[model samples]
Target: MVSKLKMVLIFISIPVISLFAQDKPELHVGGALRFNYNLSSWKEGQKTRGGDFGYDLFRINAKAKYKGVKLNAEYRLYSQGFGGGMLKQGWVGYDFTPENNLQIGLTQVPFGITQYNSHNWFFSINYYLGLEDDHDMGLKYTHNSENWLYAFAFFKNAEELNFGNNSDVSNSRYSYDVSSSGDGLYRNKEINQLNLKVVRKFSNGGANHMLGVSAQYGGIYNLDTENTGDHLALAGHYELDFGKLNVKAQVSKYNYNTKNPAGQSNDMIAMTAYGAPYLVASEGTTYTLGVAYSVPVEWGPISNLQFYDDFGFMDKKLNDFHDSYMNVTGVLITAGNVYTYVDAAQGKDQPWLGPVWGGALSEGTANADWEMRFNINIGYYF
Candidate 1:
């Protein structure tokens, strides 16, 4: 009698579920959980303490669509890299045609390579200077064709982080945003920015190439002086794919002209992220070059491997300021929903790689020795 009653309830719910599925608006939610292990050469204590292994992050990805309207959002909680849980990006968009769309709210800026310029996890050095993979509160229009892509955006400013008792809560967000110099010396913020990006893609002799150019202009508002200065960045990038090998190259230049409160030097600007504020050179040129090769494997549950080498450099024009350099060699392994990266990274006068924790992007040390970090990151995706 109990089995018969359970069968009757199942028979009733299948059609009910099918009915709602046919008419309901579409929604999808997914996320990832990641962890990290690292041993740094610069941290001498870690040598005796053994390498550190810890939680990295857990992030949510959500998308919803109804008719022509769409919504996309991603939020993350970090165990190490952020002050607290933060919204990575959230936007609402509309599709007017099959080839074009518009997005408004906290959206990605169309500048210097659409998604990334590096193959390894540490991104290009340009990311540290606020020139790559940066998002802002903005509106953007994008159009795509078989051989061409274009995007234009107008940003009111960077995402405003929560401020508590401090006069200026500098960091606590993804991507670099101008803040204070930590000493009462300088104050500036990103505002009123415009971006334009165009890409041309072509295929020849079984090889595909993508060439792109991006331009940006923005305001740097000073909190103490109440005057708005300006900042500009321009970049060009090229990518190629032949069989299982990929190559990426980009060059970018940036300038920051800020109006400070009387005694600040124009040669350096203050930028913040991850709950800390630091200085960066006011003017610099950056370059990125990367290459990767992939192979399919059948080692038990392991399915694929990608080996890559990515290099980035920053050239500061200020007098006596040393440049920054980075290179990462790594392999990415995939097994169904589990993915992992094994990387050996080295850098000189670089921030996260580290002998210098602050201002390494600004006036770097004089011919510093290279530092190394052996790291592994693993994640499970849903």
Candidate 2:
């Protein structure tokens, strides 16, 4: 059977070819190569281990256009431990009018904030909750005006690299999604998801502001039970930009109603990325806050500097679960085509900051110490 990605392309080609047959096509290509270095307090002897810097990732972006029809795609290559090669996103779209269009294939789900909800190297906690920068195999419709915008989408599932939720659900994915556990003890997949986002853009007192709301509902397929449970989420987001200063805030509540096998817990579900799976609380409300200011600098090879701090907190509905929190204070330096992020990120019960890889979004442990990581990510784009 053809994979979902291939199926969508096959189903849409005929009309796309005919609709834009008379126009000349245009193509563009670009991408980036990045590297990372970090030191974590939770590691007993990370520095002594003689390990700190390594290749992060390399990605290629391509865009093709023919009149009203367009295609966009990005593919990435990562270290084996980071899930190897993966297609970040690929979509075909058609413009029905200047104000609206439709996109199909692996596309972004409009939610919480546009591209990202954080201003630092370490994203806000919403990302771990699977509510930020999430993408899936779907079709999205969007319409916009001078100050008002709306988007609606229907996702069959998260990008399906393989057919089923087997022992090894391919972790060659860009965004976090519910999936089989690395141990294969837990198995589930996202399906039949619907999403809606609306934004109102305005300015007052010389400051531009945006207020938006997003809602999503979806099914969680339990491979063990052969039954489908559902998930629901709602969010309110706001942003402000004044001169060189910016402020952002958002609150979101999410519930994962999973249909697990007998004797299993329903209070948590598994999500995977970079070939590792971890548990996230089944129900919670997450909050985010961030502020940043950019200033031009005269330092040689450095054109600008941006200082920012982003904070995130999560409160689980279950009384017994410990809450989670994260904060990243950093500066971004831009010089020509090179950009670097230097961050001091701290978190409690967050997986990336911990000694191990998995358990980034799980129920926190009592007396868990806040872990701090000093990180620098540098990339060159062309």
Stretches off by above 4 angstroms in model 1 are: 1-23, 162-170
**How close to the true structure is residue 288 of candidate 2, measured as C-alpha lDDT?**
98
Candidate 1 vs. true structure, TM-score: 0.92
lDDT of each: 0.88, 0.88
Report how far residue 323 has shifted in candidate 2, in Å.
1.0
Question: Candidate 1: what lDDT?
Answer: 0.88
Worst 10 residues of 2 by lDDT: 163-172
Tens digit per residue, CA lDDT, model 1, 204-233: 999999999999999998878878999999
The sequence of per-residue lDDT tens digits that candidate 2 reaches over residues 1-382 is: 5699898898899788876675878899999999999988877688677449999999999999887699999999999988899888899999898889899999988998878899997789988778888889999999987898899999998988786435345677878899877665568889899999999999889999889999999999888788999999999999999999999899999999999998778988888887677888899999999999999998999999999999999998888888888999999999999999999999987888765345546667877788999999999988
lDDT accuracy of residue 339 in candidate 1: 93
In terms of lDDT, model 2 sits at 0.88
**Number of clashes found in candidate 1:** 0
Which residue runs of candidate 2 sit more than 4 Å off their true CA positions?
Answer: 1-22, 49-51, 164-168, 356-360
